[model samples]
Target: MLPFFTNPYPDELLYSAIARYHFYSGNLDCKDTLEELFGSRSVIPSVEIGSNFTILAEKLGHQYSVESLLTNHTIYPYYASFLSKQRQQEILENVKGDGQGLYTRLGIVAGGICRKDGLYYCSTCAKADAECYGEPYIHREHQLQGIDYCSHHEIPLRKYPKTNDSRIEYIRFELKHMDLSPLYEIDSHKELAIHLAKQAYKLLNLPLHYLSREQINSKYRTLLREYNLITSSNRVRQQEMYQAIKSTLPNSFLQRYESAVNNNDEYNWLRILTRNLKRHVHPFRHLLFLYFLQYSVEKLVDIDEDDGAFGRGPFSCLNKAAAHYKKFIISNVIVTRDFKTKNLIGTFTCSCGFIYSRKHTTDMFEIGRIKAFGDVWLEKLHDLQQQNLSIRAIARELGVDFKTVKRYLIGNVEIKQVKSHRDNDDILGIYKQDLLKEIKKHPNLSRTALRNKYKKQYMYLYRYDKVWLDEALPERRYGQNTIKKVNWAKRDQQYVQEINRLHQKLLQSEKPIRITISKIGKSLGTLANLEQHLNKLPKTNKLLNDIVESVKDFQLRRCYKIIDDLLENDQEIFLWQIQRKAAIKSHHFHAIQPMLESYIEMKQEVTNNERTTS
Candidate 1:
């Protein structure tokens, strides 16, 4: 063992501590020092060092487990909360064995390491470290990828000039040895950078417990529901959720982290988070989601065992007269299952007679629909009335309508209940005779026609007097005997003639007009009828099919034409010009790129040969 080894600084990486040890001990040879500390010289030092914790502990004459190093020094806590106990164990085993192989599988580099390209350090921390410990050291938080600022100081982190690309294997470079450049603080990104830094710091420093994938998924779903990003049946409003996330995070921050969700992509990280937890996501991505959802690390990791139908309650009482008004003591939660919609309706009630309900799926809750205020809320108007306050004044004070204040003042504050279908049966019975007379007067009229004339009566009869209504207005039968026959042969000949005329017109047109079925069909409104009788209109079908072009074929033809025109005009044959003229989407340009290139080469060769002959 070495004569002396320094204990790791607060939030300092194990590798950084080892590097500091080498600096203090005047150990110039990196391979030898690594062999002495880790019992093997084959180990490569990474930003997040692992595997040799036990060996290092043994060399230092101390007892320490791999978990202690991971928790106290590395960025394990950020990922630990999202991983299952088994997965966490696997990570520990991988780190203890190969060290670097598990990072990719764990999604650490999923977003790609574009922003964090070097060894970063906070200048303030570097100066403080030099002053206090007589030498500057590398901080664990500073080394975290995508973290650009110091969480404590809120200053931009500076990167070492050549430490990241140093040729010396396992180089023990301290902060004092390198020339640190000052990082300019971007005002707009400062807040976001600080937030990211703080979150990253928490992950590196905190001792977070392991949470299962199911637990994390549940939390995300709950947040989505609360944000109204999901429907009653638990279907995600993808567009809305996308828009919400876009609006929540700044474009610069997203671009910096490479976590921006594209509008056209069907699958994105946000959507992936909502899916089943079979795959592990990157810890940075988890942080992004948690930040977007406004969930702190503590809230995310702490799974509430009592999250039942009414567990979210102790919801504020809506009834103003109740002693526990807005005190969140109300616990009357009734869950009603709607068989037709397959929806669960949760009705929350208070002792003071205020009630509210929401429709949700079996596993989800519509928290946004949880209305605490009820008719009892109007009781506040009573106090205003006693004070002789104007309706407008009361309305403004309570943030309600003046009309509502007036109604409550007149003692018309009773809550209105919705009338059920059964309750309307009596009213329908009164109009039964009138509905029958109207149907008889228009016996030739169809059910839809009759319903239009007597909408309310027809709806009631359709629901209650179905048998009578069906008898009075029987289903219309258009059998061969009753139906008007069409001479399809004659219609087919006429359509063929029209199609020929249109085709001739298209051929005669001088401009580059696209000949599509829809364009021809629009000119001939009876094309839908012709399409229906394609078997009988074989001549017309053949004529239309001859001119029809698939989208790819049409785009390629247009592209060729555009290139030919450009060549004839002696203009530059640019890809953008071809794309714009052909109306081809940018994504499809690559598919036909080789063909275009070959054609361009051949045309240029022919032109050169003609020029040489001339």
Candidate 2:
């Protein structure tokens, strides 16, 4: 009296003593038994099978028609993968029952099994062989553990997988988050963008083989996860960069370009950035690689080309990558002395295919002014070379992602280290054989006792001599010292040698100027003549002859103003008779202000004086 559905196979099931094959192992009227069993027993099916025999043929993996074979196995008109015309002819000859089966072949997407309604299910979707979960007996209970389920399909969906390939792909799919209005991250180059969209259509929209459904589902699941992470993170960073750059653009971001001021467009800066991206080597080098990846890709079943082998030599992946990023060399960039003069302008093409020019000039004398795109990339590549810093330290110092730093460092440096595994350390051989002899002699010696015995007595023997131990052990010669006395003595000698080096350096240096307390007064008196007119003073102009050649003579004359201002600061300094009137003066000040009480009196007196003088 066991239950009818006792031990169901993971994929296939026949109800025996308890919903298994032994009960109906004889293939006893599949149609009639199902009908009788449904009517008699209240047993529920975990999976539902379809009614049509043609569907049964497909679920069980037998070809029924040409269309079914082509779509199901990825077989095609001429350039097909799975089945040839001869195979199709054989399938038609062997598996097809009648014209009725061939008529139903048009339905399968990537395969001939449909589980649209809640009754019929594919065993791949369910845990049963060729049973439809979405149709009549769709069981949500059969969904995979730890995942949300389609009530229709009754299978667990893949959420995450433990692999790098899946992780990167999952980030790529989170791109739906990038749907900020109508803007799109067209790949670094528009051509790559166009090609990628096509690949996206093929990969995302098309279905995989029914036989490979497990593989396909796994791949897509991983892709979705990676896509989510990549798009979300990059979109956030891009938003921040856009906001930052927006503020620094011209005219409160209303005008970003020289032309924007003329045209008064709000998005002129964005337009300019887009135009510059098309022409710039910075984006284009990355662009070409993406473009090649897209264009060179074929279906997974396509033959691997000999010419496309990666990491070979000469015309290998390295060479092709180098050639791919080679720049269009433009020469003889002109420079002008004045910025406002006619100069070479950086040219750019816009997204709408119009050229924009900006006022920029390349220095004719500067060496790296006219480098190719490949040259600039090579310079960036050189930065990853191992010079002084460790990889982690370099990444932290440069403020770049660890992965980005690791990519370059691994490519340029790590590979070299791995190839040259040359370790030249001394081998102080640890012979465990010596310990076995002591263990045999003293069977129960405690670890401390063993150590004391080995050191005190064994060391007194020839191999580990006590005479040598007395000389080696610090307690015998220099007691109560933390560091070994010999090591301390050596360090002390090094310290003395360093002191001698510093003394020699001090002797080599010239003696500094000695300042006497009396020299301060004499220096101030002589420094006053420096305040006189340049032509009146002896060699005042010659003293600044070199300085005046680079800067104007007016600037040289201003140097004397330093002395004039300093002299004015001293109240004890003598003043000369002035030809000007009202010459009563304050020290260090250009002029004295009249008091508030004397203001009106001064105005009246000054007016009277002017009138009297006239």
Candidate 3:
């Protein structure tokens, strides 16, 4: 084994420790360090989550294991807490191995939250680190993807310079890269940023798989109901929720982290967070939503699923026969929605076996119906009958009507004559006659029209005489049925033609718009068809796969267009001027800066050569 290794500082990344190891070990090449630690020089050191930890644990001796390093050193727990237990286990196994599909599994690559291009460190933390350890090192908390400030000091984090070959090199904090000066100029929305940073830090410290996606969704629904953002119909007021969240977060802060809410975009993170639970959402977006709800991460997880629609339980039992009447002893409540009215219906069950339902059309609790009076009420009725009380008196005692008391007494008769089956046939015959008469009067009426006109007769006949009802109704004509097989081949050709025209139009437009399949499909009014059935449209599918552009490409196109306009007007060009005209965000522009500079230089050279020739 090697001579010794540096113990990781609190919240220090395992990758950062390895970089420190490389320095102190005096290895001439990083490959030698990698070989010594992992027994494989080909291992790629990742900033957020490194691979081959099982081997590294062996090299680190007894003090470090794969689990300990993964828990305290890496940022895996932040994502793990929101993922399924099964998925967390799979990710843990991946971390133990070469960590293939690790980031993709964690949803980092597709999470839509932009990660920092390089390492980040708070300047104050760096100074303190240097003083304490005689050298500064990267902290895991500072490197979180969307967190801008240090939670401890509440100061903005400065990004460290990235190595030329990050795939092969592990960067440790260096004094040359450190700046000790305090930043007096504060960013806008400092309070919101600090809150988000603090929440993110809490998530980083949470245990593995602390909360499942279902639990998170339940908590959000509870809060949304309390905020009165849920409609009476049980649907989330998505537009209002989006507006509220937008108002809480400044647009600049959102744009900086690439978490901006677009009202027109139906699949935005806020909408998805409210509805879909299967998809793994980034923890940073979760923090934004929590901030909107004004809940800390700890409190949010602790909030139980006491859906506010029915309010918290220990609801009053409506059983009048029992001594516990109107007392809050009924702890079990089952909430469901009315199919026809879309109103929430709460079914409260008592331990005494009485069950009653109430529809939450309003705050008042009016009994919609009593499902079961149970044995307690039944025994109470028998006792009142033994006292020889009148039907009305017993009804008053039992909290039921006289007709209900009489019906129950008659229903309890031990030896009653059974009614003949033909007694029900007589009722069915009356309904059947009415249906035939209606059909005879309106010969041209289809089944639907007939059903609507004579709904009661239609329903009675439908339930009891379904065979006869089907025979009596008009036969379904061609193309009347709902399920019609599509001629996919012909439709595919038509869509391909329409999409090709739209694609050309998009390309030739003066404004630089990102070429995405969704954009093309939405323009064609076939977004759903394209998204779900594109594989069947082979030509369209291939074309979309080839033509779609990344956001960076679209930014480049906008930048080049601005440069061309400047050249055409014979105006002097500058990087800041190009960026302002392009309207691309600063951080995003930084990615394409080198290419933009080269393009401007090339254009200048062409102009100079033309002037010389002239």
Candidate 4:
């Protein structure tokens, strides 16, 4: 068995511990140390080194498994919670079998790499480690990309340079052996840097389970709804949410992490987060969203099915006389009904026998209606009443309505009666006789005109006095002296004569114009009338149909005319020039290409024979 170090630091990574072991054991070569520990020499170490936990545990003679080492030291815990169950198991198997090769499979590289140039180490942490443990090592938290400062110390980390060649397999974290760069203070965005660092630190050290995609999506939607970043029907307010997220995170931080979505891109990551997540998102993205929403990892990971639904409850108990008075244990829920009207009811009940309900379509409650005030509130009201305080005054003192004070004085605890439509009908009855007299005075007037003239009376009568109003008002008559009948046969003959005249006039023109239905109808100024009587105007229809040409035929005719013009001018005929002059598109020329080719061949042969005879 290989001798390994005991008492590793709380934040020490597995790679750092192994590197320390290599140092303490006087091993000079990293490749040799890896070969001895993992029983393989094909391993390549990256900044985010992983997958050697089981091998290390076995070699160190420890009883703990790979899961323990990963949860305590690596950043896998943060990413694992956002991955699927199958993915989490796959990650564990890969880590136990292969060292430093699971980042791609785990989707950590999906957002592109944002790590610093080389190895990072906090000067304060290194000094503390050397003073306490006799040596300093690389911290896994500081090694994470986009984390500029140490989470604990809130100080900028220093970088260590390395060769660009891949020949260097693994570097041991020795403060004296490495060339450490000078540290610089973070001039701007110090608070943002520190906050992100602390969150990353928490993620690295905390032990969390894989949160289902559904769970994460639910948590995000809940936050969006709370912020009014989504519509009631669950469509995301993309523009608003995008602006809010952009304003919340610094531009430099977003650019560094590659999380900045452009304003014009419709299918950005923020939109995808609100939609059904079809694939696993990177952990950094999840952390970025959590940070923007002002939520910690603990809160996000602890979200349950009961949470982010209906209302965030442990609502205050209104029953003051009960043992749990004023305690937040009551639950306000929305009870849905199948009917359209009165479909929802908000119910609030305490375990102490006090119940209050309000009919509302939403789940929100009226705080003043929580009548759970116990005997103490009643006693105060009673004292005030005895001291000659008015109902309004007593209600103002107790922070309740005058009706509530009156109810308490009357010793009645029943719920107040809700107003119904019948009351409105009584109010409308006052104007019933006047409306009837007006309708009788103008019997020929249309119902719509009368209703508009007396809108309120008509609406009330339409709702409550349907039978009487229908009988009193005249019938809604259509086609009353408005529409006139026409002899279609005579009109058809007139249209045919007009079309023929227009066509003859076009034929006599200096430039022949195409005879079309629109042209004929427009000349006669009866386009609408001709269209309306088209079925009866068979002669006109037949004449127009005979003149219509297919697109290919029209293009061929135009090309022939161009060729005739070119021949008469004794100009050299070019196919491209002919097509351009004819205004024929490429597809049209292709359709009548055989005729064009034959004409070109005939013209070429005649020219060749003339040259021979000459």
Candidate 5:
């Protein structure tokens, strides 16, 4: 039936665009489209009216006459660009001659990496400075084939020449190492997926109509099992039962529908479906059928059945029954990690128009529980400790906590764990060693990177938020410890920083080390003599060992002396200071160390005495 009409566009192009849309939806009804266009506030009116626009207004709303569509001025700009010489050249070179298939023809991997054309790779290139630079060539792959050299390095492509076959093999070899799902090993997850599919079927189908409890059980026997939500079974018994019940429902049931006008014509399908559901089934009860349907259709298949295509009037009341199933499929399914907090989240909406949402927190939650649960408990305890306002009063004002506030602050609360100040993918030892080297050179680097570097021995660490430190300095517990605090403290910045770097070498190390004071002063970088430096060693050998054994040896043993005159002023001379070196703490130091001169002589004397005794 013709609904309404309106002239909404000014140009031929605009009318043509509307025609194309009608063609796509298979709807020639211009009335509905015009009605929607007129109803919206933001849709703007076209500039001027022409014959094309007039024809669009009067038509069956089919696309502009096919003849007019072939030559529209609106698309000329894009087509015009194709005529350019440069563009034509590019098209010629890139376009394939014999089209295998548009999709299969163009590929990133099939053409690019499979061919073994010799190419430059920075990682495998000659690293000039490292000892391996001149060493015998070691192939990154197939080392048994010996040095696989690229031509760019001025080296001959090894005994094995680079070939397309080799390149394709390499591509496949590299691809084989990709991490893939271990689903093949887990049987339970797949079983659960199947069970959920059957559940989807129940949720999607039940809204056909509502019935009383006794009628539902006697007529639809399986409805009771579905109603209780006992869905863990590997099988669905309700499909057969529901089909039987639906077939037996009498036509007189339409009399139960509330709408009086819809008795003969102008049927309100949604209203009738709701009426049946209210009378015979659980409200929103079709959600079970929807879940089951979702579960059964494996990842590849989609359900497109339209049970409610025709209104329930004279025949096919079952189709009339299944109409109101759309609303149950509202939210997209969210699958979260096992941890309550997500390391990853998978969100999906299936093609069946049925939404299955669940939060799955994987093992990461267990790890967080280990690290964060204690802190969370402490936070609860602290909140409980502070009781200036009554919990009820606080809840009234802030809208959240009476007990929760107390729990997070006073009881079993998780602490706000500062993530470990380390990078997971950092070049491991290289990063730390490089940072120590940087600090040695640029000890007073004001803007050095704090993200990956730490200053050792003699650095003054100050971030923009200026709680400052230089060599074993005491940090202030109160505010104003960072750069933000120090900018205003014209005089205190230097002094506060001096105190902060004081304990840079705080951790105790297990290795014994010998400090050659004479050689250390050889560079004589600063003006200290061997005697002056050695004089700073601790009074007892144990004290000296403790000082020297620390990870930061030189600074801790003597640097503290300069800080508070920790050394009581006996600035004499000496050759060297000796302390144990760091090695695997699992073994005795002597057991692992090379025999010393003193140990060798002791061993020789013991051997002679053993011989005499024998």
Candidate 6:
């Protein structure tokens, strides 16, 4: 091996260390340093991720390896963490050799988000480096695409002027060329910029293949569901989600990175990021989206093993007739969709063979419909029937309807008839003839009216010759003339109780669903009635007026939910974070701005008081 090379500094780019070698080795050209380090003068230097590390490792002796250089000295880990295992291996191999197609494979060449045109450095970091090590080196974190601020300093980074020969030359940081002045004044966007920087830095330091593409996708889908960006039908609410992300970051900040969302463009970077996990997205876009989701690198990688619409199984059986009722013995769940509602429906099958289905939600336990009662239930029904129990009593015992009991036990039951002279053929024929004559006389009247007009003849034929009576009567016409009066007071009382129960349920739900009159009415299957006859149901009307939420009210509830989430995690409360999580538009947040601030202040006081007392 040649004379000792310049050692890499903490988080220094491999390129930066090599450029320092060129300066220290008295090399007149970068190619000379390349030849000495890589044993090949034609190996091109990449700013972010350098190539041909295998040769450089050999020239540098046993002190370094290709894998070590790639993982430690270069920015490969940040991008590799989001790639598949096979792709990570492919990129590692490429970095070890000539690195042909490396940028293409990493999706950087055409990654939409533009990389910095020249080397970037933080003034504070550079000054500190100069004092500590007698020189400053290019930091890998500073050179990342879409990272505008220094993660450590939380200040805007300055860019070094590029030379005309940048394509062939490796630029080293020089104290003389450093512009230590601030690049831009701190504004409202600075906080967001710093967030991106910090998250990007964390990703840069992550271990290779820390997360796979599938894991990231799963994590995203789960979070999307939590944020209400995905429907119960497993469909991504793309437009609403897009607007939420768009509002999270300032337009100028996104524009600077060439990552601005185009509303009309169907194939924008954000859409592509969520749509296709196999297609590589630049780490910049990935980090940006993670910010929109209120996630850090650690949180995004902490994926749930089962993040399906219906979460992990060993689901509970809802069969009331079985021995394992409400027990978590079911390991099988067949997920399908409701053809009419397009909502996800999960069918649970137990070992006892009882089957049932319901609409899928995180905490839903009620069965929508039963597909089969299985053999155990049928045997139970037979045993119950052996006691000569009435159909209603059997239904109550077996957890079914009286009609269901009758349908199942009809063939086994014996019907007894009393002997009567009305059953005679001549008498039945006379009753049928009289019913047919009455029906012909009242052709315009309904069957009920005809029956009322000829009550004696109808009753005689109804008991003795019901089938003949039905055939002789005309088809009943259901018109306004046949309408009956309804008891409005009874209907009102029934609806009020149902609405009250639903209101209580909404209050206990973990996720906030906006309460409106329409939502409450539709959920209780009384929308049409509530819409037209709400005034008639005075109690329901009053309860609705008191519970239905306005736009601002719903937004405030969301803010409170977000606050509770932060407190549960022991995270500090921040207005920007609350706003982002709540997904409230800026103008709308203004409406509840004072209340949010007051609530936060109150919570802080309580927390502080508790700490003081302890």
Stretches of candidate 3 exceeding 4 Å from the true structure:
225-252, 262-266, 305-343, 348-355, 358-379, 385-614
Worst lDDT window (10 residues) for model 4? 335-344
Candidate 5 — worst ten consecutive residues by lDDT sum? 312-321
Clashes of 3: 0
Report the C-alpha displacement of residue 108, candidate 5, in angstroms. 24
How would you encode candidate 2's per-residue C-alpha lDDT over 1-614 as one tens digit per residue? 21232232322212111123223344343433333333322222222111222432343343233344333322121111123234334434432332233312221221222132222222333333223322111222221111123323333223211222321111111112222122223222333234333332233223323212223222322322222211211121234334433443334222211112222442332322222121111111111222322232233324222211111112111111233321322222122222463233433222111222333323211222211213323344456444666666655654344675677655663221111123211111122234446666766655545457555343333343335433323232223674542443443344335434443453343431122212322433433333343345334334334222222222222322332333345322122211011222334122222221243345446656887999
lDDT of 5 at 297: 20
RMSD of 4: 16.4
Candidate 6 residue 25 Cα shift, in angstroms, is: 2.0
Winning model by TM-score: 3
Q: What's the C-alpha lDDT at position 285 in model 4?
A: 69
Residue-level lDDT tens digits of model 6 in 163-264: 537566878888898977656674767887788789888887787677877677777888886676766556678999888987887788788777888877
Q: lDDT of all the models against the reference?
A: 0.69, 0.29, 0.83, 0.68, 0.29, 0.80
Give the count of colliding residue pairs in each prediction.
Answer: 0, 42, 0, 6, 96, 0
What's the lDDT for residue 343 in model 6? 69
Model 6 Cα shift for residue 66 (angstroms): 1.6
Candidate topping lDDT: 3
Residue 270's lDDT in candidate 6: 78
> Model 4: what TM-score?
0.52
Per-residue lDDT of model 3, residues 1-614, tens digit only: 56789889989998899899999888879999999999998998788888888988988888888889998999887777677667888888998999999987888866747667888889999999999998999899888877888899988888787564757787878988778776645566787788888998898888767787767887888888777677655679898887788788878988888888888877777788888556667898888888878899889878887466877676988889998888888776777767786566788777777788887555434677877787787888899999999999999988888998998888963322223476678778888888788778888778888889889888988898899999989886555676888988898889878878887899789777788978987888899988999878888788777788888888998898899889989998899888877877789999999999999999889988999999
The 10 consecutive residues of candidate 3 with the worst lDDT sum are 412-421
lDDT, candidate 5, residue 21?
A: 41
Pitting candidate 3 against candidate 5, the one with the higher lDDT is 3
> Which portions of model 1 miss their true places by more than 4 Å?
1-4, 22-29, 52-61, 112-115, 164-168, 175-183, 210-213, 221-230, 235-237, 277-282, 288-295, 298-309, 312-442, 447-614
User: Of the candidates numbered 2 and 5, which has the greater TM-score value?
Assistant: 2
